[model samples]
Target: MNSFSKLRFRQSIFAKFTFSFIIVGLIPLLALSYISLNTFSNYLERYAVTNFEQMLLFASKNVDDLYTRYNNESKLMYSYGTNKGQILGETIAAQTLEGDYRLTRTVDDFLQTVLYTDRHLQSVFFVFPNGAYQTVTKQNRTFDFRYQFPDREWGEVLQQNRNLLSYFPTHLDNYYLGSNQQVLTFGRNLLNVVNAPGVEGEIVGSLYMDVSMGAFDEIFQQMMLNSKDVVYVLDQNNRILYSSDRASIGQTYVQKDSNEYYRMQKDNANVAWKIVGELYKDELVMRTRKIINTIAIVVGLCIVSLILVAIWFSRRFSKPIRSITREMAKVESGNFDTQVTVQTADELGLLSRGFNKMVVRLQSYIEEVYVAQIKQKHAELNALKNQIRPHYLYNTLEVIRMSAVANDDNEVGDMILSLSHQLKYVLDYGQETVALQEEKTNIEQYFRLMELRYGEHKLSMDFRFEGDVLSCSLPKLSIQPIVENAIYHGIMPKSGKGTIRITAEELADNLLCVTVDDDGVGMTEETLHQVRQKLESSYSLDSGGSSIGLKNVHDRIVTLYGPDYGLEINSTKHIGTSVRMVIPLGEVNASAERHNS
Candidate 1:
């Protein structure tokens, strides 16, 4: 390995931080991006499957509806006479007029009446067992000698399967000379309907209705030609009932081998036919590829940028500490007066100050070793207290700064009083705890400042307390961070007016629960999961910009109470979010402990 690689391999803080930061940061980001893409792909596929199935179902229903109309027409024709045998008893030979057989005329008129009644019926025919037949078309009428049906196979099949409705494929019938056209046939047995006691009725003849295929041609064409999806309607025998590829019609589909395809089926009960839709996956993914690729590229660039930033910051931080190390090395060699100077007000500056104090302390230790322990303890306690006071003071001054900016434009002095009340509450740290009512008042003043800053009507709040739960004491500012998160991160980002509802209730075993619910653009599941994970673990301000406020609130609650008490986040996308705070109901301090004991 090169010298640089060897140096990075060592357990140096700079190399470890840089490497760990990049690995810890980029892995989850990349993994999450990959998972999200796959999730979206699955979602799209499911959506497409639903839409295709619905369309196929609709097409099947349409075909069924058409078939039902014709089926019902056949039933209507069978019920032509009031008596069961009235219509079927009339024989063609019996219709004699003026000593000339008027059988041809009587049969022709009967068939023509049926053809003309329904526009879809192209032709009609009836054939009896007595070697006589009559047929009628929309444009012509014909009487024929018993020639038997042209499709003799189907004819024999129909006779064998008597009294049942049967469907026929597209075919040319030469029964009429001038009226030969392609038509779909629906035929059934015409039997004597009369019920005579102890007598069996005989079959009179067979009735056939030839429907023009042109009626359904338009429907099938519209379904296929308008969309890129492929559709196929199949019969019970798996024959192509209708297809976008007209040539494929009448061909059987035996589950052809193909990948990246989805199939959906529907049954047209009226016709006893099945409809199948074969949708190709390529057609679906083509439209979504651009979006997926864009997201992948963006995520990749983000990871690269994060890695570069980690490297730059790690180097920047290590350089100053290396300088401090060298100065400490000089002090190790009996240079008690040595001091390191750092101007910036950061950890490095604090380290330099400590280093300076340590050098002075070591020099004093040589002269007064007996008092060193006492002096060091006192100095450490005073230093910690001093550090805490400034941080609290800085937060108070920030609120005052915001209030002062608003005070310049308003004539009313209510803003100043609210800021004063907030300032006084922070400065008066004589007690580490406060009454529940005083904390509520402090929250009210903070809300007033927020209202003036954002203007009225942008946000609203409703507070509810169940049975004196508000009387219980809580740490000062425990609820303020939660309320602030609801406004800034939750409600403020929404498009419409937002409402936040805060409710306090007393639970069993001296536990108090406060919940804040907001009407806002709620978090996505991934975001909610991330936030919950942060709340359950150690809270860090450096996690992200938006989660900082929530983490602070959760950490404070958990720190004051036990691990069982903290904040819980529940959210649904586009609906809203609810944050519940659980804590013990009392002041959290030594004095409260003493009083209870």
Candidate 2:
């Protein structure tokens, strides 16, 4: 039955290996496939939008360049008559009704030169302040002589702001008779150039140039990648100046449905116009579908292949592991002689060999080290028992003595009882740590004995413990020795009554600081220096005067906690002495609990 149980355990391990391997391989593959599909679609959409934005930027740049060219040509026309000894502004300023025909011929010839330079120019008109105008057109079209300049909106804008250039959105060429071509117009007030310095010139007339929509058509057609894609050129008010849909021209461009298309716009820097492009979403989906399908098929194949490989690998991997497991079971059942056969030089075989070596060493350790430690512990306990016997005998004798003395002097009897208690505490070798309250009780008894031995008024003891500090743990006899030093060396040498203040408080960084301060005579600087040096030295064997007890307490504290914790002595000659001991609260408590256990 045991063998069958072991066999079932090994089979369960094999099954677990296969299942874990499948899960580990399958989850990431499925996640990657899902991520790849979504990532490819997002990437395609982003790529299309970026291309559309770049195309609109190029179209806007082209439109800006076209506007700049026409602006420069208009300036050239304004300053053309300079070579004729007078500018066009001056000629228009000097116009009269009788000489208007000759002025018209000259202005028409100058404007014709600019009209023929670009085939997109529809017409150029120079309208004088008196409401008369000279016009030229690409086609030899007649002009509307009845049209008045000062009454028109664009004309009035130029007349009011003599230095302003005005631009108009697409409208029918109404200045030319029987003409219906859609054209964008530019109107600028022509200023007479003043030869004298710091003199402002007055407006002579206004120059108006009209450009056909065919100029923007060429730009849009070159950038369009699909027939469904639409482009619009909009003025500052969002009204369409030109669009792929001719009917939408001159109307406010409403935003297209975002779900069906990707839209981008670029603003022209030279003009208050923007180029907008809308690309169909169907094109982006069509481009990403093929990549997504390919990824799906590849991921499916990888998952299928991973399952077959996992099953085969788990079977091979479990055989050697089963042999090791059976040997481990034997070891668990107290058969340390058991060994596993290493069939290969791989890591599993190394594990089998290491297992056999570990068992040999464990058996050797139990025989050689473990048994010897137990024997040593027994011997030490016997020694401690032997030492406790003498103390027990001494305490019994002292108790007999105290009982006999109690019949006469009760004070002396009580002091004898306190001495017995102190001896018991000092002699007990079992506990290395005691609580603050226990140590405090021991100190109170010692002071009681001192008070009874000497006059009660000679030495006054005060203990101040802050907030549960009496429950904190410290090494046994840690404070008692220092109190003994203060009494003998500090208080006894003083002339009058002396005070010993013992305070225990929790300091920062999990430290417990206990200060034994006395108003007795303090040491001189040189003697205090020597005493501090003795306390700091680890190997100092100076059993000199009162420092003996101080050094012992300091050494014990330093040994238990690290070197960072120890006694610090501050003294002034003929004034007082204070000895401060800082110890780690956590380590002392832990040590006390460990020793008790």
Model 2 error, position 466 (Å) = 97
Off-target runs (Cα >4 Å) in candidate 1 are 1-15, 31-69, 81-158, 172-183, 192-207, 211-239, 252-255, 258-302, 308-597
Q: lDDT tens digits, residues 298-416, model 2?
A: 88898999999999888878888888888889888888897787665444544666677666655555677777756755665565456557566666858776786867877877777
Clash count of each predicted structure: 0, 0
The candidate that wins on TM-score is 1
C-alpha local distance difference test of each model: 0.70, 0.79
| Native-to-model Cα distance after best TM-score fit, residue 278 in candidate 2, in Å | 3.8
| Candidate 1: residue 319 lDDT (0-100) | 70
Model 1 lDDT per residue over 352-397, tens place: 6766776777677667766785687478657756645645665675
RMSD per model, one decimal: 18.5, 22.1
Following a full C-alpha superposition, what root-mean-square deviation does model 1 have from the true structure?
A: 18.5
